[model samples]
Target: MEPNLILTALFLISAAFTVVTAEYVRPQPRKDLQFPWDPKPSSQPQQVHISLAGDKHMRVTWVTGDRSAPSIVEYGTSSGKYSSVTQGESTSYSYLMYKSGLIHHTIIGPLEHGTVYFYRCGGQGPEFQLKTPAAQFPITFAVAGDLGQTGWTKSTLDHIDRCLYDVHLLPGDLSYADYVQSRWDTFGELVQPLASARPWMVTQGNHEKESIPFFKDGFESYNSRWKMPYEESGSSSNLYYSFEVAGAHIIMLGSYTDYDEDSDQYRWLKADLSKVDRHKTPWLLVLFHVPWYNSNKAHQGEGDSMMAAIEPLLYAASVDIMFAGHVHAYERSKRVNSGKSDTCGAVHITIGDGGNREGLAQRYIHPSPEWSVFREASFGHGELKIVNSTHAFWTWHRNDDDEPVRSDQFWMTSLVSSGCVAERRHELRKILISP
Candidate 1:
């Protein structure tokens, strides 16, 4: 037998061994999924939001129907006072027969931590304020995904607003308007109230991949809007990025992108994980759109391939927790590594309960999996409050009642040891374990 042919056969067999028993493939979208979104051109800025530029910087983004309108912001630390003016650029997207509104982005920097700043865009818009976090531990983040424009989405936003979170971690499926580009504007409007006041960190989901008739690659709209800190993190693609807020280094992965061991995303993830100073950021939280350990029947096996490709890196780095969306329900797993329980392993949590056009994922396949510790089917959000470098609190809130109710709650602690010591901590000092 030829050596080259033998190597090819071995590669094929290895690839086949990695595939899940159940085939998971996304169906093509319908052809006529677009809806009319034409509106009178307005000069006023709208759909305004902010994202992290760096530890001491915040990037402000907005949209306008009129491309000729000025893209500028007047901001300062005091209310109703303009100390500085910054100018930005605007971009527009045309897909099929629809042209999107002009999107603008500006980065404001040299900011003081733990201080409030008021700003107005387009020079004459209403004033809004946001606070930057201190350069230390104890940052709170509200996370969810699969958010679309619906009554349930409104309720979830209201609850998130009341929580007064400092930052938002969205894994994927930001807007379910995959087919209709216009729906992205409505989703931007729905989340602007909260997103404008805090950094809404995001990564691309499968829904964000809308096929452009003329282009071979998708996610044109997602790439144009919702720009993340990919460049700052030494990544060339916005589909995946990493950033630090307070004492945690958050790694955002892209499920729709390639994840082979030799892919760019894999190489970048390897470099990013290698540079994390665990002493400074004790909590390592990884997030993406699909779940590698979800028990729900809706998006089962969607993250299996992704998990198999990258789970080893996470376990080697001692990642504390993993967050995901797309299942349309909430499921939390016990500390797991390589298909079994291990104390040093990262705890994977699926929080796709954020209300969207598609309702809750209610059905569970008979005989629940052993890894899932808590599971709930409802429309809501989750909160992670890092109290210090050592301990952090996690809670899932259900939006069925007048006020947010805690569907599940637990505390996560960073283990000091790597091997058997972490396993012993899981058994001996399991403080505030949730059933």
Candidate 2:
């Protein structure tokens, strides 16, 4: 064959190979689109959930069709003939396809801990009750993300409801609305059953950053609706915040935000971590949407920059466990630091298997890294039971069957001891004395 003819034949073969590979590598489309469930929101309150406002306060939130309806939460220790009424603000979000109805948030306070209070929102009908957490150690927290409205998601919720956790930590990716605004309402209803009973704390995720052409401010819908304790925690941005439950100091970070050293998040995190008194809250746990130590092939290295920017601070603070959910699978690391297993480092766990529209993350790179202790491709959620200041239990429940089965469970022990804190204090004292 002539040289020109041979070159043309090679080019044609390369082009065909490229086409085949591209087709094989393309991601399959999702089928879980939100059809209209109900055109009109009821006059009565709906989608009621709670958030911990302060040591003596709890915030109740609900939704209603009448935007002009009073955002009043009448509640007291006893049901009927309510003694206190708290007024709150209401807001709604509008999208091209559908606009959300009025969403109300009311903060109720000055109540005794470990006591149940009966409350009714939007004036009357279907009163709900919530018990404030006991001001002590051994509180349970339920965590998961990437949850959408599906049968699998319902199963996950069912399992979660059984756990009877005091608080729910959703590290972003709620609803998975993905520009279809109506899905947010549907998701709100789906989560109301569990969230209404427990304090559902959340952080911003990539999916919540619904950046359209005209409305590019991002997180307007999420920010306007799921108002967390950002203000109370001294965080300037709602995307991130810190709170305490029992003996644990929990820091919720934003993976989609600017996390450079000079960024506001970094500065705030430094301040928050510095102010942590390990003597009070012995276990320091951190949560976000993306994992810094994930071993799965789907979101591998996605959080590398984030890890580089904040890993040092976490290590210095001796964070006990870090939970994240965005990889659509379950992976638990063995106390990792800088992608390597260290005895004193924080245990990183990814529990994104919340049965979203996009299914489990099936593929994983082989010869698992030393840091990765357990990995599972399934729909599930995680429970963290702080048994004491030094010891805690971490369990991941897989929803393969109707009944809850522990895919992975282990005891996580904290390395933060009084001696360590005293030694650091002694070092500071020495520095001050030298100066």
Task: Write down the TM-score of every candidate.
Answer: 0.86, 0.88
Give the distance in Å from residue 189's predicted Cα in candidate 2 to where it truly belongs: 0.8
Give a tens-digit lDDT track for model 1, residues 300-323. 777888898889767767788899
Stretches of candidate 2 off by over 4 Å are 1-42, 418-435
| C-alpha positional error of residue 9 in candidate 2 after TM-score superposition, expressed in Å | 38
Show pairs that collide, candidate 2: none
lDDT of 1 at 41: 44
lDDT string for model 2 (367-406, tens) is 7898889987778899999989878989999875666888
Off by over 4 Å in 1: 1-41, 212-216, 416-435
Q: Among all windows of ten consecutive residues in candidate 2, which has the lowest summed lDDT? A: 14-23
lDDT, candidate 1, equals: 0.79
**Best model number under TM-score:** 2
